[model samples]
Target: MRRRTLIRGAAAVVLVPAGLAAATSAAASPRQKSAQADDLVGVDVSNYQVGFDYARAANEGLDFVVAKAGGCQLSEGPYTSDSYAGHVDGARAAGLRVGHYFLTGDFLSPREAADYFVDNLHDYRSGDVLALDVEVLDDSTRLWNDAEVSTWFNRVRERVGAYVPWFYISTSALRSADWSRTIASGARLWAASWGANDGSYPGPPDLGGSYPDWAAHQYSSMGSVAGTSPIDLDLARPWAFDVSGPTDPPGGLPKTSAEQDGVPGPTMWKRTQNWLRIQSGYTGPIDGVPGPNTYAALQRNMAGNWGYTGPIDGNPGPMTWSAVQRLAAQHGYTGPIDGVMGPNSWRGFSRFINADAWD
Candidate 1:
């Protein structure tokens, strides 16, 4: 009973161990509910140009992008092809759904890795995704145990929130790790079982490679998209919006769950984070951690410069929630500033958050 069972489709059961219960306590916030395949079309960019060219693949029908941020440093040299902030901005400008990934290994302790990831990626805005690039077999000396890996993932999620979906790269290197026991627990599985698409899988079969809610499969590395260079397999679907239907303009900000009674504190916090990302041109993960970058962006966009002053800290407090509510009201949302965001509030904010305003 302590275990959480995630039922996919009809009879498929995906069980998350009780061990991960505390780590991923927050629920997956409601996304726009687009069909998985429709939103499944995204690719990872590492050795590409410095800036993302949205218009580059505009003709190829590229719907989303997952890029490398930073991970444990290597003695051979640090990979500096792209900074986290630049990728976020470039992807946004290029009209692509964006996400960030970090290489994982014993390069640093889980807490240190977490802290490094946070510090490096504080400027992410509302519309992007944050992913951990957790596959590499260099020095096994710095890798974390399962519990540590899970904790690190949860820490990232708690900080990033629902706007950014957490994805794991399931490959040979990752599957061979000791922490492999809990590989696909809370995060979506992005399978890299490269094999012949002719009904033959060449990777580890028991690698927890099968999940009903599995978001994507990287079936091949010898494929190519329209504008980009040849790379791994494409996403099995298209990009999805966080909320369904037409979202209203920006509205009033969030209030506390304690203060709002029925409203959930985490949900309000997520709304605050989402609003700041949208307003401040941040396209990083939407988790609720409120790192330095998230704070800096909030400060930059607050009322004086088109942003209502929210909590000055990187964290989302009542003031930030209030600002979101008011801004949304400007776009025809008439919700209360009580901070208890029901479907009505979300619908309103969704409009502005995913609006043509980016145009």
Candidate 2:
């Protein structure tokens, strides 16, 4: 971090109209001015392990980057990290415009989705764009139908407000839904048509080339830029902005514990507990406790990705414990789920909710 240099208000007033004063101000870094550049070319790096190496890309004529922020209905574990914080800082250092993408989740209510987005967006500021990756599930996953999905997208736009350039990724799932008109009406489109990259994606062969309305085409899935891995699209179109204001909605979450003193809350916790119990066929008080029955429900849920290796019994050995821990951590729960609680776990949960809980 560098020391702050103050520019007097008199000088700021005189330099407002000509633009040279602000351009020449010691306070404004080269990166801040770079936001005014034309034709923004960048990529959407959403994978966690394969991080953003902006300096290398900038050397390769990269002008901007849309980093991945969250995914799948408020599922946690950021694709970006503190290293990425400095990575974007380096991009700014290299005079590149930067933006972000939020992978939309299916099971989340609109409000929950908004909360997830706001939590991750605290780092972004003026002139940045906000994008929504609208392709998560395939033909399975009954979380949301096409129409319901569109509604969720609109809810996101409403919550995010108009300061940022709100955009959408049109994946195969989006194409199948035939909700193009519905979605495009509100958001700038980032169409995904894999011709030379991820084999033949469905629909028109030249969707990207022909779709004049799209802000950018996710031209490839296995993109191999210099310092990055073979990841998804790593490019975007420039000139997508008309204003240079805050890219996120104003007024973030209350910072202190006392700020969330009293309020009626959603039944998501109860709903989640019940859903898990029935899936495991366990009889319990739907208490928010992560008891054996709750763990049973989680095991069944984790059969695919979260790492549940054994039967749906109440015991959480190494495998089951690992899976439970992974799922909990992904959803922004940093506390240990070793069927135990302590001060650290309580602090983690408190931070996770960022709001007061009713006793």
Best by TM-score: 1
True lDDT of residue 124, candidate 2: 73
**Candidate 2 ranges beyond 4 A from true positions:** 1-39, 47-51, 73-87, 137-160, 180-185, 198-212, 243-359
lDDT of each: 0.48, 0.45
Q: At residue 166, what lDDT does model 1 achieve?
A: 48
True-vs-predicted CA distance for residue 184, candidate 1, Å: 8.5
Clashes of 1: 50
Against the true structure, candidate 1 has what lDDT? 0.48
Kindly list the per-residue Cα lDDT of model 2 for residues 134-185, writing each as its tens digit: 6543222443454554454555556655534444544554435544333332
- Which pairs clash inside model 2? 40-238, 42-234, 42-235, 42-236, 43-234, 43-235, 72-105, 73-105
- Global Cα RMSD, each model: 17.7, 21.6
